[model samples]
Target: MLRELASILGLFRQPPQDASGGDRTLVAQLVGLLVEVRAAARSNKDFTTADRIRDRLSQLGIVLEDRPNGTDWSWD
Candidate 1:
């Protein structure tokens, strides 16, 4: 599950060779998709999957904030 999620989130993507980095818009979209998946897992009472998702993101330096409106994330 972890591997699948990581792959889907492009965690294995190669680092950009240029200083400009990669596409910010695409990165945001990918992160948003993962966040939605995490929300669905939580709503389904699948805390293990939710936690795994959060942990994996954290390992990538993405900090997640659970707000009343929704979950927000930022680079750590």
Candidate 2:
């Protein structure tokens, strides 16, 4: 999953790790930011940006599931 995350976001100089050896907090925060941006783009009727975010995430094995209330995600 970290490999997949790296593929999607190569922003980290090195991926941060925690005691458990996976930085779940950082991952969630970063991905949550993307999700928020995507949602904002959708709300603004910017389908292109929203679709691009979704497609990129999908390519990285992340599945963004849209719901009436909000969006949910999981590793594919």
Candidate 3:
């Protein structure tokens, strides 16, 4: 778990490489899909899924905020 956390942190330091054509759109769609997955996991009481998502996002330099009403996510 510690190693995974370290690996995820390392991923955040690197930016996505420049892509051509439809790659940008694809990336956006993928991100959206991941967000939905995270939401579903939370609804299903699958915190393992949520935590994995958060950890993965953290690797990408993304942070998740847990609020009483809902969750908010952002990247740095």
Candidate 4:
């Protein structure tokens, strides 16, 4: 299922000709924020906060799933 979704998104994942360092930095920052929030929720054992974070990401077109190993996230 995820492979199919990735294939679909691949059609839209064109490389930017003039990408800058800032783009990578911004992406790193957002990922860091997500990790921090996830850690906090886990530390507090607050599933509600974790669910809210997942739902918010969903609203932004990202899907977050809690798997047996850990949490997985993807964007569409």
Candidate 5:
């Protein structure tokens, strides 16, 4: 979750002053789609698939912590 948020924020901040809002919208949409896919994988019992998503996010400096309630994430 945070990985994509960071990605979106990073994208939005890429421009010195005014960023292209279109890129931010696209980033948000993509992030939501990926998160839904990851959630579906977890719901389907494909832990390996879910872990792959988590690992990929981690590689991007985003940390994910799973709890009984849900998953929480942060970026370095």
Candidate 6:
């Protein structure tokens, strides 16, 4: 599943392990990683790559909002 996630965004970042099935933490690691990759692309001035990543996440129902501070996302 992790390998497939790399394929999903053409980015190679491992999903954080969820210890206790919750990581004793916050959001889904995979979603977080995807957002990170998108941000990195935008930072590199690669809007095309960023857009592709955003579109892929949207396909999975993850909607992203661009903010001056950063990007936020949600889905229904």
Q: Where does candidate 5 clash, by residue pair? A: none
Q: What is the C-alpha lDDT profile of model 2 across 1-76, one tens digit per residue?
A: 4346656765344433421335566666777888998999999999999998898877755689999999998766
TM-score of each: 0.75, 0.71, 0.58, 0.53, 0.54, 0.63
Task: By lDDT, rank the candidates, best first.
Answer: 1, 2, 6, 3, 5, 4
lDDT of 3 by residue, 1-76 (tens): 5346545544223354555446545544555567777889999999998788888777766677878776666655
lDDT tens digits, residues 1-76, model 4?
3235435644224333333566545544564467568768977999787766666656546566777777666654
Clashes of each: 0, 0, 1, 0, 0, 0
> Model 2 TM-score?
0.71
lDDT of model number 5: 0.63
lDDT of 2 at 63: 87
| C-alpha lDDT of candidate 4 relative to the true structure | 0.58
- Model 6 agreement with the true structure over 21-48: per-residue lDDT tens digits: 4542334566677788889989999999
The model with the greatest lDDT is: 1
The residue pairs that clash in candidate 3, if any, are: 8-59
Off by over 4 Å in 4: 1-25
- List the pairs of residues colliding in candidate 6: none
What is the C-alpha lDDT profile of model 1 across 1-76, one tens digit per residue? Answer: 7668667766636442321335555666777988999999999999999998999988767789999999999877
